[model samples]
Target: MSLEKKDEHDHEGWMEERDLTAVEERYLAILMWLDKRLRLVDYLELLEDMYYKVNLQMPKSHTEQYGLDNKFWYWYPLYALGSFSTLAYLIAAVSGALLGFYYAPAAAASAGDPTVAYTSVTSIMVDLNFGYMLRSIHRWSAQVMTAAVFLHMLRVYFTGAYKEPRELNWIIGIVLISMTMVFGYTGYLLPWNQLSYWAGQIGVEMALSIPLAGEWVAQLMFGGFTLTQATLQRMYILHVFFLPFLVTALIAVHIGIVWMQGIAEPH
Candidate 1:
């Protein structure tokens, strides 16, 4: 309870009186300091609760409750698809952030001239050192993330991991998949190349095909019926800014839920 350090000898005197050795003294001193500042004791208690709750749901282990210990299940490899997808997502996010330093989203084009956005991409590939490899890593990581997510969903579906208490996680997984697709689509539009241009035109027409608020939807999403500066800007913001924060938050929640529920192992 006495927090006064008074002098350099005070901590040593207190430790000597308690019969604590050098390492024990230092460790306890640091621990107590952190406990006072951060309330480490409370969080440690919560962690203790989670550990027992997740590991010992009944009088036995999770594997015993799920009856996996007695079986020779060949599906353990597939169980890691969720983590693999998360790895791919992290790779893509980091690489994309590095690429953001060189990317431009402006779309002002002249006769027989590439737009500013397209020129920036060209500069990144040609002028910036190692830019080609960075772009390649970003593109391939995104593709890998997409594929891994699909395989993860299939595994969840076929294994019935979407049942009962995990229903919320299942729903969250669906939302994550949709967001991943949208993230890819928006990234596809950032280059301002011919392919990206035509693809975005298709997106615009699709939005316009919606029954009632077609024009409004197009205006909101694509910034008009045509691919313009606004469209490029919108895609840039969604892909680079908004979706990162949204997806990261959802992934955190998804992992937190998993931590609470424990994994659905084989039976």
Candidate 2:
């Protein structure tokens, strides 16, 4: 190999070809100097390669397989339920995160009249600026998500979209629906108002009715077969922390499967 002086290489000629501004010239000069020392561009290319390699590959739908000529295959209204539920889930997540800043999970106030949890809810609804709207949005989004998920399941069932290779997603859908119900229930109990209190009591009783692990389920879930500070804490944790991660993961899988199977052509 011939010994070559790198200073003989003409980077200025390369820059001159593009007619860069003074600012761009300085930026490129600094970048080139740093890149010569640290090889940043090589690392960036590696990252870009990895990104493209790992990118999701969505499956083609029936319409795409044949042609855009098959417009009848891509019905918008009923097929939109999946996307609608996803949108509602996003709305609930954002509003719930904002509501979390002001929420306390204690079951009772110092005076023991209204529970601390209930007081916090009242404060969010009545005192904090735009808190009512924030909470309303959260509540409504959750409700809408639930309704949309249920309707989506019904749509899939009636259309026989759950058959053949789609059975796994159908099972996952059942789990997601159950998790959604639990999400709502946990959030419902967080307020610790009279209705919530009775609701928790009912939950305890229902858990205790399970044959084998009845008492264990009651203790684990309801905090010793009775509603208390622990109950509220548990509910808050499940609602804000556990269920979010679980539901979000299931949602990602559900969407991924749909992307693969392409919304099971209407039967």
Candidate 3:
């Protein structure tokens, strides 16, 4: 017999001698077959090592340290606000991307007539299948994220999580909340309806109210001081391109800090 045949024969005999269940035999056979081709065992061992290294460094909460049996969700709802807001932001981003495929940003219209932007939004709400539900999901998710982020800040403040080594993260959180509001405001103007038009006008006024960089801010954001096609285009670009990238990067940094520092348990 060849050496390979001898090894295979020995493997079969070993399995038979174990008195294993039928399921166990099948599972071992499959595992050995794949391990021969994939070297999965080496990767598994590496992952196990990494798990232990990371697990050892993480700080235990007071409940965990004291062997208390209290569940986190039932005992401490505020601890979850950060995660909840992140979930809402992700939902809004996905729904908004889907809606983008059908939305028009054109605002060309004569006086008292609906622009192409408004008409496209109306079509989505009334004509397209499941469009209303999709829009509702995006809108509601944005609102929920806003509320959750606000409450998260309040929780951090009340818990003193913003003190000491966390002051930098607190500043980042403030920036995140401001950017969240800007995200909602920019999306709100995409429809170019009467409400959106007025909202854009108000944004223009607010931008122009700045002392040193008023006109520059207004021009950069709303495009030349009027709620025209340029304004809608700028808003669409910011909503789709600029804000998403910036906010996503900020969120990654924020989460990285939290991972390094561990959750700040309230006193």
Candidate 4:
């Protein structure tokens, strides 16, 4: 028997035998080189198998499975409300990030006057280029997201889509809705205008109205009893950093669970 290994199974030889084009030959050569050293082909084959298996097991759409044609549904628009809300959230996040670049949380510079934070917002809206439009887009998107989320909840409730297997998703939806409101409320205070100031005041009052830990909640959230620099800073951080991360993670998990559970069909 020969001590040297045979080159009969050489990938280059195989490519030549198959009469591959120049590009295909180069691609195959590199792929074979990588596969020989890394055994990537086996993993790729496993992934492909899994992909096909998942596709095969995927559930058919209700209309397609039931062969229901020409059956226009009234609630079909409501079905898309969740997706619309998600889109709005994404828009708000992007615009809010851009707005954050121009906004200042300092309220000390003009203490008796409007406030540094308020002035910063005025500058953004009136002085900076396209800043007004950016803020408008962010505000509108946030409003739209809140509205969509509310409607989505109502749709889910009336449709009885929160039964049995979907109860966890329903709870997740509720959490997301609450987070969405928080996101809006926090962002609303970043401007530090009269409206923003009063809203923050109301928030403090609401927190203080809670039973035993009311004062603690107010302190933790608003950073004391008054809407001072601390309050603006806290709101800015919540709007631009904390709530964004938390809400985004929760939204992703909520959507992922919904995807896995599949859309509930009307009976």
Q: Return the TM-score for each candidate structure.
A: 0.77, 0.75, 0.76, 0.79
The CA lDDT of each predicted structure is: 0.89, 0.89, 0.89, 0.87
Compared to the true structure, candidate 4 yields what TM-score? 0.79
Model 3 pairs in collision: none
Better of 1 and 3 by TM-score: 1
Evaluated against the true structure, the overall lDDT of model 2 is 0.89
Residue by residue across 72-101, what tens digits does model 4's lDDT show?
A: 265678889999999999898889889888
**Tens digits of per-residue lDDT for model 3 on 1-267?**
555655654777888879899899999999889988999999999999999997887566776886653654454778889999999999999999999988989998635588888888888999999999999999999999999999999989887899888988999999999999999999999988778889999999999999999999999999988777899999999999999999999999999999887777643
Candidate 2 local lDDT, 185-225, one digit each (tens): 99989878888999999999999999999999988877788
Off by over 4 Å in 3: 1-52, 55-59, 66-75, 110-112
Q: Which 10 consecutive positions of candidate 4 have the poorest summed lDDT? A: 67-76
Model 4 bad stretches (over 4 Å): 1-49, 55-59, 69-74
Among these predicted structures, which one has the highest TM-score? 4
